[model samples]
Target chain A: MDGMVLVITSGKGGVGKTTTVANIGAALAALGRRVVLVDADIGLRNLDVVMGLENRIVYDIVNVMENKDLPVRKALIKDKRVESLFLLPAAQTRDKDAIKPEQMKELCEELRQEFDYVLIDCPAGIEQGFRNAVAGADLALIVTTPEVSAVRDADRIIGLVEAEGLRGPRLILNRLRPDMVKRREMMDIEDVLDILHIDLLGVVPDDEAIIISTNKGEPIAFDNNSKAGQAYRNIARRLEGEEVPFQSFDNPSFFQRLRQLVGMDK
Target chain B: MALLDFLSRVLNRDEGSKETAKQRLQLVLVQDRASVNPHLLEELKEDLIGVISRYLEIDLSAMEINLESGGGDTVALVANIPVRQVRRSQQK
Candidate 1:
């Protein structure tokens, strides 16, 4: 049976596309699904580093797409921690034009036959790299932040994804701060959903553990206490067709909450 | 009085950064969804003035052309042209 080709893309850079791919790939593998994370951001590849598989890369995706004799398995680097998780690194020396859309589709087809999920790390912008990353995908996960610019870029990307004949992309709003939202200092999930008008895949709260994990070259999904990690796992479960209620990022003070519950406080 | 005013300001806060974000996003997203660039709109407005002025006495400066989002997936190009009077040759 062929697996799903889910391309994780954000039109703007630094909106956590690579981070989402790494965390979700790890989460899915932990759920016992064989997953392959493909970094389609050719020259500026970072998915391998995020997954801590940078040193293990013997062959890149460019080599696999170019060489007819080379088997695709040779480039698949199994994650050190997760048994079922693997990564297909991108070529740093080559440019985005090195691999055509058709070649990327063919590569995904071969990968789908072996893995349960083919998660592609799409590059920023609506160019050749974006086209190549999106060509083979059955589902598109548009990642964005609560910031105005990121949301605008995500809106543009949603139009392009639908125009490509792919299904309507689900949104993953990353780097949210519930405290800021409560204080009316930041855009909340509802405000974002109102504009994007797509089904919500997940909402990831801004957590410092994410940065720590990234620095350590490990996916935050393994840390149970990390709110962002829990969000990624929830996204993975949602992808697996599970209906999970969104976790409350509300600040809970025992005394105030108790008073509210007893109808003594507003 | 100053302390109470400060407390009220802190407690009764309504408009915040999120409100600003929402307003900005709504305006920008409408333009983005309509695929209407401001520069392109300006050029279109100029060309439209030249074309319409040749046939009628119109207020070119007062004309308004806007790309509006008419809800789900519809972009409406609404143009308001104020015609002062029709040209005598065109009236025939």
Candidate 2:
């Protein structure tokens, strides 16, 4: 089966790139598609911890790249929770320059043959790390928050990504506070889309459950009660070529009232 | 005073921080995406001053040239050249 290599990236740090990668990888794996999460942030690796597979990482991407004797499969750590999910963690000691872009491309080419989805967790900034992360990818998912700085960086990254020949990168707007949006204090999804001018894959509402899940080394995608989890699930389904309606976060109460009026709330 | 402040804020909902953020992002992204080099802009300004100086006597110090967003994917080169006097010479 032909597989897809998708890079999860944000030009600015702390914009949920890693979180989005972990959750989306897990969600896709839960869909029974074999998925491998590659942490491309060499020195500042976080996808391993985020995936809760830090202890299982005996060999990382650097090990596979530097040691000609090491096989790529040996470095891959299978997820404890999801049967089809795997992770190739980045080396904490090595810097971004440790692996070249060509090597990343070769690695992705090999992984795509085995896994149904190869999700690369890209580092922040448009540096060597970012280039290496995107080198082998067939598609890109730009993650951004509603904040001005994040949006600005995302715009720059979008240009850079398109320049790299990866056209039409989908967007995932994360950490959106719908209450603040309702109060006209936060940038809504439309405002962000107007600036970024990309097809939005999904929007994840700011949920406290995300923090709890992250701290516990678990993805919120498994938490059915969390709205953010539901959002990730919808994104995964969208990736799988399914049409899922976006959840209305701005005024759920209005929808609820309408449902009640139509006697559809039973 | 607090009540009046709240009432004023409520009345002027368009002046919310979200609008400010959106406007600021739109303005900034236009400049960021334009990627116009400072050296190029300076050269352009000098060339503009040389060309326009023949047509009109302009104040060089007060002049400002900037790239502004003309809404959605279009950028405008805005030049604010204060004209001190117009040269009405028949000579080429």
Best by TM-score: 2
Q: Over the stretch A186-212, how does candidate 2's per-residue lDDT look in tens digits? A: 999999998889999999999999989
Question: TM-score of every model?
Answer: 0.83, 0.84
lDDT by residue for model 1 over A211-246, one digit each (tens)? 999999999999998889999999999999999999
Stretches off by above 4 angstroms in model 2 are: A258-266, B1-6, B11-14, B36-76, B79-92
- Tens digits of per-residue lDDT for model 2 on B1-92? 95886698878755668988998888887688656346667888999988998899999999999887777645799989999999999226
How many backbone clashes does every candidate have?
0, 0
Docking class of 1: medium
Which clashing pairs does model 2 show?
Answer: none
Q: Give model 2's docking category.
A: medium
What lDDT score goes with residue A266 in model 2?
51
Q: How far is candidate 1 from the true structure (C-alpha RMSD, Å)?
A: 6.2
For candidate 2, the TM-score is 0.84
RMSD of 2: 5.1
